[model samples]
Target: MIISSIGLSGYYVNRLVQNSEEIVKDNYRTLLYIEQMQEDLDEIIFNINNKNKTLEALQDYESVLKKQEANITENGEATLTEQLRVGYTKIKAHLEESNADANLIFKDIYSTKKYLNKIFNLNQIAVKDRNERAKKAADDAVLYSSLFALTAILVTLFYIFKIPEYLVKPIKGISKQFQEISERNYNVSLDESRNDEFKEMALSFNKMTKRLQKFEQSNLAQLMIERNRLNAVVEQFDIPILGFSEKNQILFANDRMLEVLQVKKENIIGKNINEIVSNNDLLNLLLNQENSNNERQLLRIIVENKERLFSKRIMTTDTEISNSDSLAHDSIIILDDVTDFIQKDVRKTQFMATLSHELKTPVAAIEMSTDLLTSIKVGKLNDEQKEYVDKINDQTRHIRRMINEVLDLSKIESGIIDFELENTEVNLLIEEALQTVQPFLKNKNIRISTEIQEQLPIVKVDNHKVLWTINNFLTNAIRYTPDKGKIDLSASLKDGEIHIEVTDHGQGIDKENQKRIFEKYVRLNKNEKGGTGLGLAISKEFIEAMDGKIGVHSEIGKGSTFWIKLKTNITS
Candidate 1:
C-alpha cells in the first residue's frame, strides 16, 4: 500500500508540472503577441508624426495593428494585452496632434511594457515553485522505495538466520532425541549449554531420563519380587504350575509341575505341552486363535503318573488374535493342582450327607417319644413330663433351623446354588429382609428406621439372592448392635446408579477383619457371633452373578454401613 501511494503521488506531481508548463508557455506566447501590437502602434504613430509620409505607409501600419490585435485576442494569458490596447488608443488620439503629444503617449507604452515584464517574471516564479515541488515529490518517492526494500531485506534475513538457528534447530534436536529414546537408546541427551530455556529444558530432560532409568530398575525389581512371591506360593502349596505356548511349547514348569508331569524340569521346559501331557485337546484349542478379547477356558485333565485331576487355564493378551496377519507373543497356561481342594470338598459333602442321615434317627426317636407321651399310651403324663416334651419340641425346632442354615451354607460354599434372576423392587427386598430381623430388633430393643426413595425403579436381580444379602447385613447389624441401638435402611438413585445402604449403631468392624469378612467361613468377631460364617460370602457371590457390587464402611466402636450397587436395565 505504501508503494502504491508513493507511485500515485509521483504521478500527480508530474501532472501538476505538465499543467504548469503549459500555462507558462501560454503566458509567453501572449506576451509576444502584446509586444508585436505595441510595435505596430509605435510605427503607426511614427508615420503620423512625419506628416510628409505617403498614405500607403499609413495603410501598411494600420494593417499590421489589426493583425496584432487579432493575435492578442486569441491569447488570453497576455497580461500586457490590456495595456497594449490602451497604448494604441492613446497613440491614435495623438496622431492628429503635434509630434510632442505622440512622444508622451509612446512613454506610456514603455511603462506598460515594464508592467508586462513584471507579470512575466511572476509567471516564471510560479513555474519555478511548481518545478521545485515536483522535484521534492520525486525525491520522497525514491526515499520511500529505498526504505521498503531495506525492510524486506531485514525480514528475510531474520527468517533465514534467527528463526532457524534459535527455534527450528532446537525443536528438531529435541525431536531427534525423543526418536532415539523411543528406539530404546536411553543415553541420548539434549544440549543445554546455551543458558536459555532450551538449557532449562535439557536439565529437565536429564532429570526425566534419570527418573525413567530408576523406574525401569524399580519395575524389574517389582517383577522379581512378584516372581519370587509366586514361586513361594507355589512351593508352599501342592498345586502344580505349568507354562505353555500357542505352538505347544512347554516354556516353563515349576518343581511340582515337573513332578506331576513325571519329568525333570529341564525335560519339561523345551517339550511341547501336548507331548508332555496326555491331552492334545488343549493344544487344538490354543492353536485355534479366535477373538483376542475372549478369555480361554480352564480345561480339567488327567496327566500320566498323576492320579490327581489337573486343570489348565489358558490366557493370552493379544488385541488381534483372530486376524491372520497378527502375531501373538505367547500364550500362558497355568496348571493348578485341585487335588486337595477337591478332596476337602468331597469330605465336606460326605460329612453333610452323613450328618443329614444321622440327624433323622435322633429326630425320629424324639418325635416318636413325644407322640407317645402326648397320646397317653403308657400312662397319664404329669405337668413336668408335658413341660419336658414341650422343651424337647422347641429344641428340635431350633436344631432343624440350624441344620437348614448349615445346609444352605454348604450349598453356597460348594457353588451348587444357581441364582434365578428376575426384575424385583429393591425397596421391597429390603422390607422383607427387615421383616425377618424385626423379631431380633424387638428382642434387642433397638430402633430401626427406613428411608426408601419413592418411585424407585425395579432392578433386574434374583429376589431370593438379594433378600439373602439384605438378611446378612441386618443379621450382622443386629448381632453387633447394643440394646436400644439404631439401624437404618436407605435406598436412592444417584448419577444414574441405584444405591442401597444398611447402617447400624453397632460395634464397627476393624480394618483387619473388614477385608476378610467376605471370605468363605470368615467371621469378623467369632467370639461374639454364632453362625456358620457364610452370610457375606454367599451374599457376595449372589450379588456379583447379578452384576452388582457390595462394600462396607466401618470404624471400631463406632458403626458400620453396608452398601450394594447394581446396574439398571440389565436384559440378561
Candidate 2:
C-alpha cells in the first residue's frame, strides 16, 4: 500500500514538471518572435533615405507587428496590452509627423525598436531561468523515484524473509502463553537458545510475564490487608477519610465518610465527589488544585445536600515516573467533619456576647448610684461620708473599665472589631496613644518619657488598633509604677519590623504569670489593684488582628516593660 501511494505521487509530480517546462518554452518563443519583428521594423525605418521608401518599409513592419501582437495575445502574457498600446501610439505619431517624411518616421520607429529589444532581453533571461528550474525538477523527480523503488524492495524483502519467525511466530506464542496462564498452567515456557534475537526477546518476555503474575498475587493480598486496616482506622475515628481523583471520582470512602453521607461504600466508590459532597462550588475548588501551582489546600466547604460542614485538606503526589511535567498527578483529599466544633464555637461566642451585655447593665447601674452618692447637690455629706463616696466612685470606675474590657473581648472572639487599616506613621501613632493616657498619668505622679525613631518608615496598619495596643501597654506600666516613678515609651524600626516598648519602675509580673497574661481573666491577684484582667488579652488580640505581636518582660519589684512588634508591610 505504501509503495503504491509513493509511486502515484511521483507520477503526478513528474507530469507537473513537464507541463511547467512546456509553458516556459511557449512564452520564450513568443517573446523572441516579437523582438525579432520589432528589430526588423527598426532596421527598415533607420536606413530610410526617401519618403516613398520609408512608407513602404513602415507598412511592411506594421504587418509584422500585427502578427506579433496576435501571437502575444494568444500566449496569455499580461504585458501584451501594454506592448500593443505603445506600438500603436508610435505608429500613429509617425503617420501624422512624417507627412510621408522618412527622417521623422525613422526616429519614432527606432525608439520603439529599442524598447522592444529591452523587452525581448528580459523575456529571454526569464525563460532561460525557468527552463533550468524545470530541468532540475525533472532530475529530482527521477532520483526520488529510484530511491522510493529501492526502499520498497528493501522493505518487501525484510518482511518476506523474517516476518514469519520474528513477528508472526512470537505473536502466536504469546497468545498461547496467555491462554495457558489463564488456565493456571505455569510449566509452559518459550525456548531461548534459537540463535535469533526474537527468540531471546521471547524468553525475556516470558520471564516478565511470570514475574507480573507473582506481583499481581502479592499486590492483591497486600491490598486486602490494607483495606481491612483502613476500615479499622475509620471505625475507631469519627472523622472521615476519603480518596478522590482529579475528575472528582471517589476511589475510596472510609466508614466515617459513608456513615456521614448515610450511604454504603459500594454506592459511593467510583462516583463523582461532587455528587457525594453535594456541592458544586466546593467540588471545583478541590479538583482545580490537582493542576494548581500550589501543592496543598485547606478550605472550609459546606455540603449542600447533607447540610454538613467539612474542613478539607488536600495534597497531591505523582504516580507516574515518565510524565513530561511534574504536576500531572493524582491528589488525596482528607475531609474532616468540623460541624460539631463549629457549632460549639458559635455557641461559645454567643454566650460571651450575652454575658458581656448582661454585665454592662449592672455596671451602668452601679456607676449611676456612685454618681448620685458623690454629688453634694443630691445630698449633703460629712468627712466620713465623703471618703466612702470617693471610694465608691473609684470602685465604680474600675467596674466600668472591666465591663468595657469584656465587651472588647467579645468583639475579638466574634470577629466584630472594626480594623481601620491605612498608611500610618508609627511614631505619630505612639505619640497620640501616649497623650490619650496622659490624664491618667497625673494621679500617678510618674514622669513619662519617649524615644521615637527619626524618619521612621510609615507602616500600613490600623491606627486605632496600634494606638489601642500602645495604650494597653501604657496602662499596665502606669498601674504597676509607684508614685513619682519613671516610665519610658519608645519606638524603633529594626529588621523590617516596628517595635513599640513601654517600660515602668513598678513591681513587675512574676515569670509564671507573664506567659498566661494574654489569656482572658488572667490576673495575677484578684485584689492587686484596680483594672480588669482583660486589658492585656484585648491588647494581644488587637495587635494580632493588625498582623502584629505584643509581649512583656519583667522582674518582681524592679519594673515591667511591655512591647509590641508590627510588620511594616500590610499583607493578608
Candidate 3:
C-alpha cells in the first residue's frame, strides 16, 4: 500500500512540474519577445525623428517582428503577429524613401506600437491564465497525494490490529498451556482444528498431554502402594521412631512413638515439634536430646505401670533435591528398648564391685605378710631372698592399685559416689597432687616446674575427686616422661574456669588415638603400662560429674599436655 501511494504521488508531482515547465517555455518567452520588440519600436521612432540612422533602426525592428511572428504560441497571437509585421513593413518602406514623410512613418509607427501593446496585453493575460491552471494542478496533486497517503495509513492500521489476532493470540494460548503443563496440570489440551502449522503443533501438544496424564495416574498409584508399605513396616517396629524436617515440623511419628508420647497420630503429624514440646515433658526431653552436645543418654520412662530404659539415638540424613542445590536435612529419632542390656550391665558392675572388695582384703593381707617377712626381728634375709621379696612387693602393690581403680569405676557407674564440692585454693590442690606423685617423680628424676598465676581464683569442685584426678594426671605425666625429662604443672584463671595443665616431654600420642584415650579400658601404649586403663576414664567421669571438662592435646614428637577445666568460685 505504501509503495502504491508513493507511485501515485510521484505521478501527480511530475504532472505539476510539466505544467510549470510549459508555462515558462511558451508564455514567458512570448512575453520576452514582445518586450524586446517594444524597445526596438521606441528606437526606430527616436532614430527616424533624429534622421541620423533611420534605416538601420527600421531594419532592426523588422528583424525582431519576423522572429516574433515565428514564435507565436498563445491564442490570437499569430494574427496579431501578422498585423505587427505589415505595420513594420509599411514603416520600413516609408523610411526607405530618400525624402521620407515623417507623418506617414509616425502614423505607421503609432499603429505598430498599438499592435505591440495589444500583443503584450495578450501574452500578459495568457501568463495570468496559465498561472491559475498551474495552481489548480498543484491543488489536484496535493488532494490526490493526501488521499493516497490516508488510504495507505488506514490499511496499515487495519493490519496492525489484525496481525496479532492471527499470530500472537495463538502463540499466547500455546504459552499458557505450556505454563499449565509445567505446574503438573496435564488435563489441558490445545485446539487442533486449524489448517496451519499451529494445527500440527496443537495436535502434538494434545498427544503429549494425554500421555502425561496416563503416566501421572500410574505413578500416583505406585507411590500410594509404596507409601502404604513403608508405613506398615514402620508401624510393626517395636522401637519408637519420630521424623522431623529441617524446619522442626514433625513429618512422621510411628505407632510406637505415638504410644510412648501418649498422643494420637493426628495430634503430632505435620505440626511444629516446638509447639507440641511445650505441653509434653517427654517430648521436650526427646527434642532436647537431639541438641545435646554429649552422647545420647538412656531415658527412663514408666510404661504400663512398669519402669523401662530406652536409649535415644538420633540419625540425621541429608538429601539433595533434584531441582535445588541446597541440602535438606531430615532427622530421625529412634528410641530402642535397652532395659535388658542396662539390667545386665548393672548386675555386672555389682559383681565387679564385690570381687574387687574381696580381692582388696586378700591383697592387703599379702602386703602385711611381706612386711612381716622383711621385719628385722623375724629374720635377716639373704640377697636372693631379698630380690624375691622385692618382686612380690611390687606385684602386690600393682594388684592393689588395679583393684582400687575397678572399685572407683564401679562406684561411679552405680551412681553411688558422692561429690564433696567446696571452694578450694588452686595452689593447694596443685601442691597436694604433687606431694602424692613425689615418689614417682623422684624415681624418674623428672623435674617439676610449677606455674601458678598470681592471685589465681579458687575452684568449686569435689575436693576428693579433683585431687584424685589431678594426682592421676601428674602420675601419668611422670610415667610418660623420659628419665631426667622436665614436667610442667600450671594453674590459671581462664574463661571463669581454673585451668590446670600437666605436660610431659614423652613419646607423644598420635592423632587417631587421642580421640578415644579417655574411653574406658583404652590404653595408648599397651606394651608399656602399669595401669588398669581405667584411670583416665574414671578421672573423666569424676570431672564431668563435678561440672568440669577434661581433655588432652598431643601430637607426635611434640609431647602431651593433659588439662582439666573446673568452674572457678570467683568469676573472671
Which structure among the candidates has the greatest lDDT?
Answer: 3
Give the better candidate number (1 or 2) by lDDT. Answer: 2
C-alpha local distance difference test of each model: 0.68, 0.72, 0.86
Candidate 2 structure quality by residue, lDDT tens digits, 36-58:
56765755656555545545666
Which residues of candidate 1, in runs, are more than 4 Å off?
1-299, 305-308, 311-336, 357-397, 413-415, 495-497, 570-572
TM-score of 2: 0.49
Each candidate's number of clashing pairs is: 0, 1, 0
Model 2: lowest-lDDT 10 consecutive positions: 72-81
Off by over 4 Å in 2: 1-219, 232-238, 244-251, 255-306, 313-333, 378-380, 419-446, 454-465, 479-485, 492-499, 504-533, 543-561, 564-572
Which ranges of candidate 3 are over 4 A from the true structure? 1-180, 187-211, 228-289, 301-305, 316-331, 380-387
lDDT of candidate 3 over 487-531, digit per residue (tens): 999998887888999998888998889989999888878897578
Q: Rank the candidates by lDDT, best first.
A: 3, 2, 1
Candidate with best TM-score: 3
lDDT of 3 at 447: 87
User: What is the overall TM-score of model 1 with all chains considered together?
Assistant: 0.45
lDDT score of model 1?
0.68
